[model samples]
Target: MTERSNQSVRRAFKLVDELAENGPRGVSELADQLDMPVSTVHDYLQALIATGYVTKDESAYKTTTRFLEVGHRQCHRLEVFKAVRDELETVAEETGEHATLLIEEDDQAVIVAVQEGPDAINLFAYPGARMPLHATAPGKAMLAHMPTERVTDIIDRHGLVEVTPQTVTDPDVLFDQLEDVRSQGYAIDVGERIAGMVCIAAPILDKNDRIRGAICVCGPRSRLDEDRRSEIADVAQRAANVTQVNLDYV
Candidate 1:
């Protein structure tokens, strides 16, 4: 695409982001935020509204539900699932724990695969489940690698809602944890989203080094204490790497 076309698209996306975060706003406000002509912003807003990606409030505009549908469709379109399904089953078999495949959707994590071990456990989420980007291991593993501006925007859009006692509700604390996860190349969720459950997750990267998804293993907190945490991390990381390799991921 031409540079001018790319710039226009970026400006349109920026307007969408602003509308999503700040609610409905006038075309003049949008143009000010995006530093574009008022007519240009109005044109973009009208196009987005026509596509059902945005909704008009008389002269103002805001995001519509279509963005969520778009995100869901995009989540399934990623070829990462071809490698994740069988690997999750294998991980569940080997670890005797729940295994899940989570893909990053904007700033959220959606579970695309969930495999249960032979022994029953009502612990993990099912396929098609959505979770916050900062609460779960798989979610954090993906977020930890995102660009700083993107991460900040996600935090601004959705502040950490405390799901459990272990949940990091403070943005600063969560930022520190994300940095640590990036340094370690993985993330751990110790009953953060649900009590008595622990998860270990590693990022799955594509050939371009972009994180596509995460592979995670979930077990009872008793089974994943400090003694076995490292082992669990190793197993989860290896499984994730194997899936990435099968997809010719970097």
Candidate 2:
């Protein structure tokens, strides 16, 4: 591509990202936030509107449900997601908590599906949400099953940023915890990502024993004590095993 066309593509995606992240915005507001000229921003907005990816109301421009359509289609296309969708709901229903299926992407955990039970607490989590691998149970569960060299590369790239006061910042400490997770067949999180939240997760492997993703059950700390944690761990592990078995046919 020509340099000019490459720059245009980057700028267009930047505008779309800005709208996706911050909701509707006026032309001048977008220009100021992006440090681009008003006329340039308006031109980009016009192209986006013409393509049906964005819509204008009064003086403000916002993205349309087209983005949702694209995201939904991409998420549903994953083989692991298809295999684990029912099991994720089963986990939540049986545990009375939030259940999630996540996969690693660019060294971060991407939530592919979420199910809530009758007593589940809303963490405002949704599909396509990304979380740091080191601070989440699902992330750690997957990481524990990964090769040591691969895990080291991910940690080196992401640098284990502490998400909460309870987050493990030391690399050595995290390595030790991962060792425990590998042997136990599950991983636990106690306020590591969000304060007062607890989680249990297990890695899901394919027929060849390759890591595909992870399944997790999460809730408030008050509700998941020692006994409850052990129980939920068992539930999560079973769900993960079922998902792995289902993948064998897929």
Candidate 3:
């Protein structure tokens, strides 16, 4: 590809992704993230704005609602996304906690869909958030369901890095926890990803019993206490099953 063709699309996508993750940003910030000159980023933003994909607000630029309009159309066309969305919403409604769908991607766990519950606590993972496979409840659930070789590949690629004080960083401990997830049919994250937050996750398995993805319910520790742990877990498991069934996974 020529410089003009490759540079514009690549830089535009970087700006769009950065904006998607952290709202409107200044040209300098976008330039710094893309490792390009501010003038270059500003030029790209001008092109994007002209095309109606991005908008400018004084000194900052943000992706326009055009992306949302396209996203709504795309979501309907993606069968797996359509299949799990209802169950994800149901889990959030039933548990009164954040419900999310996560799938392993490029050796990382990718948050693909989410629904927030009535109460809001701070676990900043949103749709398109990429997290370490060994550092999250949904990641562990899906990992436990995967074949041993694939599990090892993921662990090898993304080591058990600590995200919080309670995060299991030791390889041995993480392996043991994976074993427990296999036996228990659910995975738990007690302040593992974020302090004072608890998460329960269950894997949606395919017809071959391979993990397709996982469903998770998250909330503050006080709300997701021992008294309601099983209840939340059961709801998450049922949601996962619902997704599998929708996919025609026997």
Please give the clash total of every predicted structure, in order: 0, 0, 0
Model 1 poorest ten-residue lDDT run = 119-128
- Residue by residue across 1-250, what tens digits does model 2's lDDT show? 9999999999999999999899999999999999999999999999999999999999899999998888799888988988998888889899999999999988889998999998999898998899999999999998998899999998888798989999999999999999999999999999999999998999999988889999989999999999999999999999999999898877
Top model by lDDT, which number? Answer: 2
Error of 3 at 4 (Å): 8.1
Q: Provide the global lDDT of candidate 2 against the true structure.
A: 0.93
Question: What is the full ranking by TM-score, best candidate first?
Answer: 2, 3, 1
TM-score for every candidate vs. truth? Answer: 0.68, 0.96, 0.83
lDDT of 3 by residue, 1-250 (tens): 8999897788789888999879999999988877999898989889999999999998889999898777567556655676798898889888888888888878788877889878756577666678887888998998887778887776677677888888888878888999999898899998888788888999888766878888988898887778799999999888888888888832
User: How far in Å is the alpha carbon of 137 misplaced in model 3?
Assistant: 0.7
Residue 210 alpha-carbon offset, candidate 3, angstroms: 2.5
RMSD from true fold, candidate 1: 8.4
What's the lDDT for all of these models? 0.83, 0.93, 0.84
Off by over 4 Å in 2: none
Scored against the true structure, residue 49 in model 3 reaches a CA lDDT of 94
CA RMSD of each candidate after superposition: 8.4, 1.2, 2.9
For model 3, name the residue pairs that clash: none
lDDT ranking from best to worst?
Answer: 2, 3, 1
Against the true structure, candidate 1 has what lDDT? 0.83
